[model samples]
Target: MEHANDITLTVNGTRVSRRVPARQHLVDFLRDELGLTGSHIGCEHGVCGACTVRVNGEIVRGCLMLAVQADGCTVDTIEGLSDAKELEALQKAFHERNALQCGFCTPGMLMAALDLTKKNTKVTREEIRAHISGNYCRCTGYQAIVDAIEEVVNGQG
Candidate 1:
């Protein structure tokens, strides 16, 4: 039998309570339990940013954090961001620039870009690259992705 821990948290502006397995990571809980599949599981080591999400308003790797650790915190996934219309410019820019090829890393890249742009939308291309360095995109080679993010940041989107 798997050990479970009861926890409560706010997810995408909704209050949620569940008995999660003690070993369950936040990504697993979000994907398996809450059915939020936008946050893809990549390396499972926090090295890749595929599972990036906002916990308590800070971007964090879902794979590195346990579910119970977020008991009283607010979790925001790509679904939430999309629903909030927070990623509209980035989405459009990504599409126009062909930043997403496989679409596997788009969510995480968007999440990371959200964090960066939230700080300063007028960021340089090198700054954008530095901010998104953690997110690994195997397809785009990053130039298109950088162009997309730069456009959005530079207010062209």
Candidate 2:
């Protein structure tokens, strides 16, 4: 039998309650239970930022956090940001700069970039790289991603 508990939380501004397995991580909970698939599972060890999401205003590795830990928190995934039109310019910048390929890491990269941009709109390419160093993208060589983020930071995106 699986060990599970019932919990309620706000996701993307919608309140929800569900039974989650004790061992189930937040990334799986979001993708499997809530059907929010934008957060990708990579590395599973938190070294990779593939499953990054904002929990109560801070970015966290979904793979490292348990669903129970998020019970009373407000979770924001890429879907929520997309639907909220919060990442429109950044998304457009990525598209225009061809910043994404294969797209496995795009969601996490976007989430990380979103956090970075929020902190300081005036950012340098090096700073951008440092901020997103946790995320790994096998394609695009990161130049495009950096350029895209820079464009957004400069209000040109």
- Candidate with best TM-score: 1
Error of 1 at 64 (Å): 0.2
Q: Compared with the true structure, what per-residue lDDT tens digits does model 2 show for residues 1-157? A: 9999998999999999999999999999999998999999989999989999999989999999999899999999999999999899899999999999999999999999988878765987899999999999998899999999989876764
* Model 1 lDDT at residue 152: 80
Query: After TM-score superposition, what is the CA distance of residue 96 in candidate 1 from its true location, in Å?
Result: 0.7
Q: Taking the tens digit of each residue's C-alpha lDDT, what string does model 1 give over 38-144?
A: 99999999999999999999999999999999999999999999999999999989999999999999999999998888876488888999999999999999999
In model 1, which runs have C-alpha deviations exceeding 4 angstroms? none
Candidate closest to the true structure, highest lDDT? 1
TM-score of each: 0.96, 0.96
Candidate 2 global TM-score:
0.96
CA-RMSD of model 1: 1.2
Backbone clash tally for model 2? 0
